[model samples]
Target: MNTNKTELNDQELSRYSRQILMPEIDYAGQLTLAQSHAVIFGLGGLGSPASLYLAAAGIGKLTLVDFDEVDDSNLQRQIVHREANIGQAKVASAKSNLAQLNRHIEIETIARHMDEKEVNELVRQADVVLDCTDNFASRFALNRACYAEKKPLISGAAIRWEGQLSTYDFRNEDSPCYQCLYPEDNGQELTCSQNGVLSPVVGMVGSMQAIEVVKALLKLPTLTGKLMIIDAYSMMIRTLNLKKDPGCKHCAR
Candidate 1:
């Protein structure tokens, strides 16, 4: 329950004036929000919105990790970067966008690829980690890091009008990890380029992912032990209660 409310001065107050007006996240919660740090993996379709929202919400430190470069194709869903940023490194572009949105918050960009060691370091440093990568390998990698470090994770994925989310490890001792939901190691999964996703789907899931991160940091009553599945086509959302899989290999490790 140790939180800070005086961290925001008159200038910071004026900047986060809108959010500070909210009862749930008033001056105190907004101060807590400003003192928190969230590290996001993947600067693609999902990561763009997640990072931007967290940064705008006064997250003290926002770290963006991705080695990919921006491309014309990414604009359809990656809202953090514009047409002019197409040729730049994705992490750099994302940082630029967030910095433009809020200068008071700090931005950290990792232009290098994330290996296991790097991920572990990030997990150790971050209050909440976000898994927004497009592939299972990266998701699993991040999951392992968060699990090992006992850090919370806000995971999200979207493909072809379908989006999914689940909160893991943030004091929910029995919540399922990402691998539990997807353990098959399927050879094929939908990708933005191949499966064709509506641009908003990514933002929708990404924003939700940001919400989960904020909740995790604030210990708010959000998706701590459930999966939120969203079907854009049907405009339907379902909550799937989850439990720890003792037989699961990753979290047990």
Candidate 2:
């Protein structure tokens, strides 16, 4: 991971003044964020908040991938899409919002689902990969791609007042990949469409996903080998340590 060592411009210095004041994220840290690239799959509830926060924080390049259009039903939680964006491509809507947030950064949009080859190539170029998709198939594909590229992936999911988040830094050989946590589909795929989710439930989890991405770029201690489970109804949160499955197919090699 190259820091680039480029000095922040006057406008940049003023824009990130607040973040630069922090001990953990001084001007150097902010510059690191400015030089990093992140790709996020799925522009729904989770990706919405994650993209917004990442753009506001000034990630140099943000690649957004999603093949869905903005549905009227999505406004309740997908904060990045407004009522005007109904029926519009999610990536286009996201690009408009992100462009408005940070004109200094680059925002790339792919308005289609990525195939395996596309996923691998894109993951190879990104410093961070965020799996915000809601389906197991996409999650598994992203995990495989990230593991191949040895990129850090920040994954999050929310449905029916329940949410989960984890970061897999495949660059670390001992770290567990996403497959380690869910080896196979157990017939337990519940989506917000079927079960319904609290409005803020996704926001809570998505914001944390953004935090993990930022922390990962700064090389700060992050949730790399742990899973965070959240219950919005009970307001309870728990973290579990993750171990690599020696026999796991994706990362055991």
Q: All predictions: root-mean-square deviation over Cα?
A: 2.1, 1.5
lDDT of 2 by residue, 165-215 (tens): 999998788889988999856457888888999989999999999999999
What's the true lDDT of residue 139 in model 2?
90
How much does candidate 2 score in TM-score? 0.96
Question: If scored against the real structure, what TM-score would every candidate get?
Answer: 0.93, 0.96
Screening candidate 2 with a backbone cut-off below 3 angstroms (N, C-alpha, C), the clashing residue pairs are none
- Return the top candidate by lDDT: 2
Model 2 C-alpha RMSD vs. true structure (Å) is: 1.5
* Model 1 C-alpha lDDT per residue in residues 161-243, reported as the tens digit of each score: 89988889645667678877777464677777787998898899999999888878877887766888899999999998877
TM-score of 1: 0.93
